[model samples]
Every structure is written in structure tokens, then in C-alpha cells.
Target: MPVQATSVRAPFDMPGILVPDFRHSRRFQITEFGARPGDKQSTSIAIARAIRAANAAGSGSVIVPAGIWLSGKIHLESNVNLHLARGAILRFSDDPQDYLPPVQTSWEGIECFNYSPLIYAFDCENVAITGPGRIEPVLDRWKIWSARPKLHMDALVALYDMAYRNVPVADRQMAIGQNNLRPHLIQFNRCRNVLVEDISIRGSPFWTLHPLLCRDVTIRRVSIQAHGHNNDGVDPEMSQNVLIEDCVFDQGDDAVSVKSGRDMDAWRLATPCRNVVVRNCRVLNGHQLMAVGSELSGGIENIWVDDCHFVGDGRGGDDHAVPINNLLYVKTNERRGGYVRNVHMSRVTATTLAGSVLAVETDVLYQWRTLLPTYVRRLTAIERLRVSDVHVQQAQSVAVIKGERDLPIQDVRLSRVRVERVSGTPTIVENARDVTLPAAVGRNGASALGADFKNSRRI
Candidate 1:
């Protein structure tokens, strides 16, 4: 059973909830700075100054008055509150360069190449971004990133080199087109005790909002979407305690993804993103409703995902046709060894394309570098996971659990899992060990010789 915020925790059960408590805090409005409503530049400057002032003022909020305040990347300070007035808009500028050079941030748990997000916070304690307003990004930020010719091999090489080298992300010249490649609109790294509530965010170039490597965070009653490449909503990575409740996601990719890190940096961190609960959220136009790791470096444990409606576009096409590719996706990009444990998901309903309910994959980039034990040990594996009382409809297989020989998944159980396929049967399990299921869940799809374990499962 899921652990309640007010209840005690059991050994095998999820830990108690971790919703942030923001009942007490001082508020500072942006209007006092004399910036007119809808003038993005002046208002942004004022907000930045206000954040600094609030920090200097000893823990108070910097409120955004009811209007549009256009901006680029704005750094957040500790103990500062960013409150949005009831009808205000905190719009992000579209020019990619406005985001500036790349910052050292966690992308799936490891330091990587990408632009800083529109609203960012790190190393802050007891923070909150609350409002009943909108955060709309200027799409032009992505336009610059997409202008690069895709066939340019030289450009590709340069990018790969950047991602490879532990490059200092400061004061570097970046290709504008590449920023569009990143989907993070709002991101927080290494923060503690934060609350994000009652905001409507939209139009992302990359992942919508990422809360990476943070602890004790809460996101409630918010509507956020960015229907573009990898525009995932609320990726809580490598963090300890998290609660994401009563939110709605209409995105291009996964709605909510839990991650640690990626490859070596993630394994080295060894920080399992654990004790998470995502309940009563609504997902629309997302491929995976709730996901875990295409890049899980540290690992994930003790999670609960329940009572979510996953709806799709019935008009039928790859774009909007999928409510879920994965209701629960364990995508292990572990270049280092790690373990995923104690996950419980219940009452998740989905409308789908050709995908799975539960996907356990290990595409560890398993090359020669991945063969060594210490190197191979960094690979990701799933242990002791359970899914019960799931009702999946609108035609697809029931579930798929698979892995590689280097990192085989074990001790998986599924009870009362039902599937209604529109075109064909959806149950497929390959290369998994000790897998258990309720009688008569999915009744289609050919069984692999357990050889599909070695089959590739990459994004």
C-alpha cells in the first residue's frame, strides 16, 4: 500500500509522502519596482532584482504582478519565494542565445550538454514557486536551435565532443539550434524542500519542467504542457522525497519521469531517487504517462503511481494516438551497476498505440566499455516490482517486461492486470526472470525464445 503523509511506513511499503509545507512565508510583489504590466524586459529585470532583494531581505517572496513578464533564463536564490499573481504571465523569451551558454546541470542524473532552463533553482532550501497563472515560453528559442542543418557531420561531431568532454559549461559559445534540442523549461537541481503549485505552463521546446537531484518537493494542482520533442513534465530525478498530485499533463513525451543520473556520473552519485508518490494526475497526448529512466544513473526505489487517467486522441495517428507507450517504463541506461526496487502502481488506465503497460529495458550502451564488471555493474536492473488492478483499454497488449543478459530483471509480479487491444494482442515478455502474472491478462503476441532479452530497447 502507498504510504500516506500522515501514516506510518512499513518495510515493504512506500515511504511516507513528501509534499512541501509552504503555509508560512512572506510575500513581495513585483509591482513595487514600477515596471508596467506586459513590458517583459523591465518586469523581468525587476523580478530578478526582487529575487536578490528577497534573499537579502531574509526569506520572502518576489511576486510577479498580474501581467506578462517576458524573460530568458533567471537564476533563483535561496529562501526566496516566486509567487505569480492570479492573472499574470511569466513568459520566456524565444531567442536561444537569451538562454546563454550551457550551465552545469543534471540531465538524467549526469552533467551533460544543454541550455539552462527558463526558471532555474539550485542549492536552495525551503523554496516555492506558487501562483494561479501561466508560464509560456517564447518558441523562437527553439527556432535558432533547429536552424542548424541536420546533415552537417562536422556539427554533430562537435556536439558529441562537447557531451564527451567534462567541459566547463560557463562562458562557452553554443549553437542556438541545440537549445531547442533540450526540452526543459523549468528545472531545479540539488534543491531541498520546495513547492510548485497552481500554475499553468505551456509551449516548451524540450522537457517542460525538470526537478532533478532534489529532495522534499511537491507539485500540486498545476497544468503544464509542451507538445514538442521530449517535453516531459516533472522529472524528479535522484531526489529522495517527492509528491506530484492533482496535476495535468498534455505533452509530447512522458508526463512524469523519475531519474537518478545517466551513465558514469549517475552511477558515481549512487543516489536512488526514492520515496515518490504521484497520485490523481491527468495525462493527455503523452506517450508514457509515468516513466522511470531512459537514463537512470543512481537508480530508483520505493515509488507509488496511482489513480491517473491516461487518454489519447482517437482520430488515430502516431502523434496523438498514444495515451501511453509505457504506464511504467524502467529504461536503464546504466553504464554503471544499479538496482531498482519496491515500485507499486495501481489503478492506472490508458488508451494506447502499440506499446506496453510495464517496460523493463536495459540498453546499457552495452559495448566493450560495458563488458567489464565494474563497468558492467553500473548497468541497471529491476528487482521486486509490483503492479495490481490495472485496467488498460483501447487496444494494445497487456504488458512487456524485458532486459539484457548483462542486467537481467528479476522478481516482478503483476496481479489483475487487464488489457483490451484494438488491433492485436499486447503481452510480450522477453529475457526476464521470475516473472509472475495474474491468470489471463494479455492473450496475444508471439513469445520470444527468451532471446529477446538481448533485443534493443532504446529511445
Candidate 2:
């Protein structure tokens, strides 16, 4: 059985040094791992053991000295600081099984087996990993697929006897079925007062940093380069009071994505991802610069994106290196019956090679997804969303914003959005109507298609 976590919000759900919340205190040091820079022991084992020990002692810091420490699948605890000093590297081993015994985690809201990430922290409070060093993987590009694969129980059982002599079979069994996270580089689930600053993360196996159900978290001055699959920079799921600023992402997937739970796990953990502010960041060569949904089952509210840049190298062409509906994409698939509210975006600039802007797509047919289509019982809504001062040049297509046929893109407003491309004219509102546009931006210089409106007005 999965470990049941109670849903009672602590007196303060948002925890961190900057906010008020309840959490533990723990400290540790990782010097015992016999690995050095080029020849070091598995830092994963050493760090995991350190977190376990820090919880045993009082709350404090888990110090990583300056050197190359090799490791994999490091789990974090509440009330501890995983600190790496200058000139330190927490390198991961490429052995697939070394990241075994999966834990419950998500990707695009689908629970599946993948390796536990290098630095994993779940359901924590007042936790931090602050340092000025690189947390990287020893593997080269294109070797990531072999390094992480889904968890197989039969394989776990076969390797269980010798590899896991001390760990109980029940924990192992539970782990095998849980959402395998290559353990998110750092996951703070339902945590508060989380701070990750002044760290450099490159050459990661998957998504670099993930914070789920957390509050009052801050990520600053972090340089990330995970040029591989599912390598999003930071995924803040159902969180609140988050600030991700002064960061750079050159990744293979979306740079930053906001999410809710997926399926039953998502509905059960019905937390709202709200009050997030990301500014002064550069998004280079990713699927989406900043995305929300496909997995927004829980809810998304009160999000703000400002002063971010998405630059493309003209490779995607009409295919689009940065593709989406609205520079801010809001989509709901088969399992989407959640509410998206109060999203305000401003001063966002993009140099898209292709794709649309103000995209509001819905898969009401719901035929393509893995899960059964949820009945559209309640009203499907994306209310009170606004975009302003967006300028895109040289896009293959114009912007299009549309909602599902039954629920259409309702209560969305756009102002001063300019799309300019060489060959293809940027279209707006493919099957969308009742959406508002500024008086100056009323379908200027493009041929619109598939736009069916009931009653719409220009601001």
C-alpha cells in the first residue's frame, strides 16, 4: 500500500526562511563517501545516508566538500541543507539499477517508472541546498536513455536479495509500483520555506528540479543545461508563493512548467498552483519557454510571468522549436475537469521559429489519451486570464487562441500582441470567439481561420 499522507495544512502551509511554516531541523556532512573528483565513491549512497543520519541527529546542513563525488538516487529530508562548497561536484553514476527502487512521482501528470533523480526531496519543509558548484551526471549526451528506464518488479525481485540486504521487501515492493522519479534533482513535496540558490546544474539525466505541493520557495541564480528528454528546469506543481528568477535554461523540453496532480493521485492531492512569479530569465531552445497544463487537473491560479526571453535558432522552421498557443499555452486533455483562474502575463518577448500565441486548446474528443475521457460534467473553464505587451518576430504562423467546442476559450483577454513572420501569416483564433482583444490588435494584417464567435468585443 502507498504510504498515506494526511492532508491537513500545517498552521502555515508555506514554509521557508522567507515565510512562516512548521518544519524540522537536521544537519549532515558527506565526506565518508570514498569518492574523489575523478575517483570517488557513489555520492548518492553517501548523501542518502547523510540525510537519514541528519534526521537522526538534529536539523542542520549536509555539507559536500570540494571534490568530485559520484552518486545516484539521493533522497532528501525536511529541515536540512544539502550544501556543496565551491569547486565541488556531485556527479551521478550511469548505472541504471543504481537508481532503482522507484518512488512516487509524476511527469506531465503520468505516473511511470524512471530512475530516481540525482537529488530527490519529497514532502519537506524549511529545506535548502545552497552552494556554488556543479551538480552533474557523468554520462554523455544520447547515453541518457540507457541510464534511466522504467522500473520492472521482476528485475527488482531478482536483484533484491544481494543488492538490498537491509531494506525491507515491503518498501521495495511499494517503491517498484510508485511513480518512478529519477528522483527529481530536488523535490520539495508539500514543503515550505524551501530555498535553492547559487547552484549550477548541467548534464542532468532528466528534469533538473521539481517542487510539488510546496509553498514559499525560491530559486535564484541557477544555470541549468539538461539538453535531453523531459529535462525541464523546474516543475512547481500545485505550489504557492514561489519565485524563480535570474535563471537560464538551455534544455530539451519546456524550461519551466506548472502542474497539478494526474489522475486519482492528482485529484486526491488537490492543491492549487498559484502565486508564482518568474522574471529576468532566458529560455533557450526548449519545447515551450514557460508552460502550464496538459496536466492541470488540480488547479492553476494567480500566476505571473514577466521579462523572460525565448530565442530560437531557426531549426524548427514551420515545425517550431518553440510551439504553443499563447507564448502562454493553456491546454486541457481528456482528464481535464479542473479550473484555471487569474493568470496574468506581461512584458514577455519571444523569437519563435514557428508556432502560435494565446493558445487555448482542449481535447474534448478525448480519444487520444491513455486514460478514459472524464465526463465533462462541470463547466470547463479558463477564466480571468490576460496577456499584454507580447512581441514575436519571424514566426512561421500567427497566434491562435481557442477553447474546446463545448466550452470555448472563455474570459481570455489579449492586448498589444504582435506576431511577424516571413512566409506564413500569424493567424489568431482558429476556433475561438468571445475572446477579447485590444482595439489596436483587432486581427491586424493576417487571415484568420476557424474563428466562430457568439458575441465578442474589442477593448
Which candidate leads the pack in TM-score? 1
Q: Assess every candidate by TM-score.
A: 0.84, 0.77
Candidate 1, residue 367: the lDDT equals 29
Model 2 TM-score is: 0.77
Root-mean-square deviation of candidate 2: 7.8
Please, what is the whole-model Cα lDDT of each candidate in the order they appear?
0.68, 0.62
Candidate 2, superposed: residue stretches over 4 Å from native: 1-29, 32-35, 38-42, 49-57, 110-115, 139-183, 312-326, 364-379, 422-425, 430-433, 438-444, 447-459
Compared with the true structure, what per-residue lDDT tens digits does model 2 show for residues 1-459? 011121222112422225322233443567663334554344555677777777666466678888877776677787667888899888777665666766555544544334565666667766777889888876553243424343432332333231224333233332344223334566665677788888898766666788877777888889887765567788888888788888887766778888875534456567778777777888766766677876787888777777787765634322323342236767676456677877767787777545655666666333224222343344346777777787776554444565655665556777777665424544455444446664332234443423334333222
**Runs in model 1 lying further than 4 Å from the true structure:** 1-24, 107-109, 112-114, 143-183, 314-323, 333-336, 364-378, 442-459
